[model samples]
Target: MRFTFMCKKDMVPIAGPHGRGKIAIVGAGPAGLAASGYLVCQGYEVDVYDKLPLPGGLMSFAIPSFRISINSIIEGVEDLRDNFSVKFILNTKVFKRDTVRRDEGDEFTKNTVDLRELLNNYDAILIATGTWKSRKMNIPGEDSKGVYTALEYLFLLKSYELGYLNHEPPKANKVIVVGGGLSAIDAAEVMIHRGADEVYLVYRRTINEAPAGSFEINRLRRLGVKWMELAAPKRIIADATGNVKEVELIKMKLGEPDESGRPRPIPIEGSEFTIEADMVIEAVGEIATSPFPDQEYLGIKQDRRGRIIVNDELRTGNEKVFAAGDVVSGPSKVGRAIFLGLNAARNIHLYLTTKRISKGGT
Candidate 1:
């Protein structure tokens, strides 16, 4: 999404507390960044916290620069951090009432900030934490050394590019990427650019039914990445070193539409096949991660998918707390997330102003 900055002439005054009222926004993705823009423009003290050293969330880290330039994202972030007064607390993840200890293999998390403390310190809170947890395939041998979720694979690749790592890109000559979404495409492209001998994209559906649309699939096809359809991975075959050697897959046929309005793939019995590969990347999708995982501290409501529940004003069950972007709407495009962030900022402004007016304030 193209992020636009508000001109200084169009600025609005903060509603209360001599414009020193504070707002804490969690996550530094498109939604959080956009909200920061609005709140800062409105003269509110805004602080954005992110787990990554850099901002832009998935866009800056996981996604391939070929699809979206890192320069644009960096420029927008700089506009907020430099030109505006949006204070970015980087490499810090806010947890629930009590800190949730960092898990193994979690490279993003460094510092921990308690959610309860944020609640007490800030006038309002915005949880814009986009999905960081990747949905696993849950099949056998998924823990193989050469097997990785698209998020992990892409993050590692980007880490090297960002100079965070001294090592080269993870080595795998034959890379097999699973799923039909943009994540899979990005993984395949990165593997191809990394000089992999062969990179194949396997999906259970045709390009017409892919989540990323037909254009991306066709582009990958044109780039000489092998595209195979109507197949789903069943298991990973690992060697003695626990490195991927091949991936076993089963043919599938489209069945009735599932809850997501997409044709579900029903496996064809006895149609299993295998593809020899040195590495495997699964790009199914991401999972919702709320700062308050226990959900007890804030008493905020959420759907079955773990997405935070919110009203038209983007306010959560706890009136002072609100949620925006993927944490509220689940997985979506950057454009959609940015719009949601802008909406949240506007509603938050109104909410704060109304409270002041009711108390005979400006």
Candidate 2:
């Protein structure tokens, strides 16, 4: 299916007077882009800043174009820039403080902007910096050369495919992806498309309990992607050159429901097995990433898991700042993030018009 943002009837002509106020949105992902569309239509001067070279963020970078057409995103972004006067500051990362913290999609960042500077310059600020850091299994030999996070692997190939990188991404003959999420499915499909002779999708839970659902998993299986259910990686065995050679996996069984309301996988004794692999991708999950290192910065607080804390109105502790999307609710689909972005945009318009903001840090 095609994803068109500006083609929709909601892409209203610029309404209200210009110079309503300057709004700075960090991260040009789904939420940030959606908010920009809304605020720009409302006649606010919107500037979207992202570390990537393109404006669509993950939609244009990490995610494969087959799933989300980059051309559609580019068309929408072009509409915002040409018609509504939205400015996208690409290849620049917004940071609260100068630190060495970097995420998967930050490889192409050429410049940096301080959060404090944006707060002082812009009339309003929105932080929609979605999840960027990939979760690791923390198993032995995980730091091997051939072991990569799903984002890193996908982003590298995507960067090359988009002509941002000159070098080609490495091709693996035998690949193993660990997870049951969409990322895993995407990774498996990519490997298969890249001519990998063997691709395996290993998940800790059964196909029925997978986060990506059985339909996607079964689809991958039919595409010659081996499905290893009720199994989890215990260790990544490396060759003498420190590259991944094989992965030691342990069988698992479903136990009582855990905090996620899904049956937790319990390790089965004496069920360890080793699978040969040229490359291993960890697609377990991702964590919310903000521009700051501190838990609380400028009255914006993040939860223990790194999700930005917000209230019913989607306002941050600072009256002039708001947040939305995966950064606030953790990893979510594009549709959910878009909905949250539009909702936050409405709240922002309400705040800007009335000069009264909701009190929230929850």
- How well does each candidate superpose onto the true structure, as a TM-score? 0.91, 0.95
State the C-alpha lDDT per candidate: 0.81, 0.87
Runs in model 2 deviating more than 4 A are 1-17
lDDT of 2: 0.87
lDDT: worst 10-residue window of model 1: 353-362
Per-residue lDDT tens digits of candidate 2, residues 99-213?
Answer: 7687887778899888899998988889999999999999999999889899888889988999999997788999999999998999999999999999999999998888899
Clash count per candidate: 0, 0
